[model samples]
Target: MPFRPDPSLPVPPAGADPLPLQGLTLLLVDDSRFTCDALRLILHRAGARLRRAESLEIARLHLNCYRPDLAIIDLGLPDGRGEDLIAELSQMGFAVLGISGDPAGRDPALDAGAAAFLEKPLGSVAGLVRLIRQLTTGIGPVAKGEEVPVPAGDPMALRDDLARAARLILAPGDPAYARGFVQSLARASGDASLEAAVRDSGTPFDRARVARMIEDRLNRLRALA
Candidate 1:
């Protein structure tokens, strides 16, 4: 049975903690009515303005009507490949996050320039929030030359930054930033294999190892601070 989302429902509470996406409009692209409903609930709970689309064609229609700050796109859609939509949205300057049931399906989305890849039944709402915050706030212009210098001091902050960067690799609309973020993390962590993997796979070279290394590097940097 298809779940019909109540479009007339009032927005959820703002909550005690400040909503990261407060005041931002989000476009959610998915074929399933249930998925759209769930995501709308999440976004509504966070106080974000929500627009739902069931297919690429509908998404395009919504985009023409409203310019969203961010777009959450499902990899499979009835009209066409969602990767194509990601590319189109990137040109239009919308932040794109690709969500897929099959994690392996993330590859083409990443390649197409999605800002992040979120495997569905999205695990950590906080992580998604954090990634959104980072996307809205932390991203900067890509450095022109090779050998960009790591930001000085506060290893914990650096690690957090790197973690955000790792997540950004899956974002479909910002490949240049994603590439730079991965490269910077590799240089900061001084991990040869990590660097190699990032170069080879558009995804993080080794996620677990990179996480541990990020922790270790942050600790080392913190001891000095």
Candidate 2:
């Protein structure tokens, strides 16, 4: 389906082109529906088409069918690190943009050959558009003092992510993937307590505590629903 900008979301900078990315096709490799939902709005405003793959496996499957004009990869994935995919795609001459909720992910992503990197909770549509334009064309000049508006992800999507994490935390076996997933979500949502709980969780007791916290948040979100 074609992307359509949400009217309730922020508009681009006053002088910016409404359709700067027209005729462009983008592939987003990410797991979080929250992130995908937010990017959908941004891409729609910029007049771009989007296809999504939630993991490296899925992305490779997509690549086998067709190559997109650009690929925006999330540094963390459920199956593997996004940098590995970035290295392969960049070597293949694809324009790649790496994004992560963890600021520390920047260097590894860039070193892996991503054209550019953006920190997550990706607030600014104009900033993203500018970066995409520059990556594809090597030229995207922003007007002086223009205030690029920042759009937020859908709250329900966030709720869904938390709910999934809540389930993962309780599931038997190592919770490494869930921990990283929650860490990313915590950073994106500014949930410092949740972030700390997951980051410092090294023992069974700590893991149980983190599970409780996730469950509490999930319950609250369910209440709202």
Candidate 3:
């Protein structure tokens, strides 16, 4: 089940904007009413204009009518996978976060096109707030102004290679193959933080676990893109 906020928690002050989220519009895609209600309450309190859809069909309708700066999508939907939507939205210039109760297929989701991934039993609301802020405003520690030195190979060639690797791992397929593909890309990306985390966690390679790792990589790529 999707996580819900505690009702007893203090509510936002009347007429006061939720810090860091004011003036933002968000799209939420999920099949669960409870999930939408819980997220809507939090997002609304943060002063976001929230648009919601319970299926991809409905979400497409909203997308046609509204252009949201950010989207929070659940991986499982009655009609289709959220990762598919992520690819579509990312291409359209919207930042996306994929939330799932079962992280089982997360790796493929990230490969398919999520900017970030969050597991169910949600943790600190502060973290979500911070992530959204960084994604939308490009105002986080990771948003350093320093440029990434171009690699030795042709930039387009490298990008195509990376994209192919991502597709091999993220497209719907056998779980074992997807896990290996992501691990290979993570190593090739030369992201020390991600490599270190993967080493420390030592979790068995699976879609969900790999998705979390790939999501981090995707965020870095998005920054560079």
Best by lDDT: 2
Model 2 C-alpha lDDT per residue in residues 127-217, reported as the tens digit of each score: 7777887787777554423545455577889888988787776677447777778888887777899999899998778878988998888
Clashes of each: 9, 0, 4
Off by over 4 Å in 2: 1-11, 142-149
Off by over 4 Å in 3: 1-17, 141-225
Model 3 lDDT per residue over 1-225, tens place: 223433443454344334457788888886544445556555654556777787899999888887888888877665677889988988887888888755565796688777888765344445666677778888763222222222222234335444544555446655443433333334444445644443343334543454465555555556776
Local distance difference test scores for all models: 0.62, 0.83, 0.60
Better of 1 and 3 by lDDT: 1
* Worst ten in a row by lDDT for model 2: 141-150
lDDT of 1 by residue, 1-225 (tens): 122434554333234234556787778887554455556555565557778787898998887887888888887665677899999988777799998755565888888889888875564444555566567567432222222222132345455555565455564555644444454345434556655655555444444444455456556655776
Sliding window of 10 residues with minimal summed lDDT for model 1: 142-151
Candidates ranked, most accurate by TM-score first? 2, 3, 1
C-alpha RMSD for every candidate: 14.9, 2.1, 15.1
Give the winner by TM-score: 2 or 3: 2
Candidate with more favorable, higher lDDT: 1 or 2: 2
C-alpha lDDT of candidate 3 relative to the true structure = 0.60
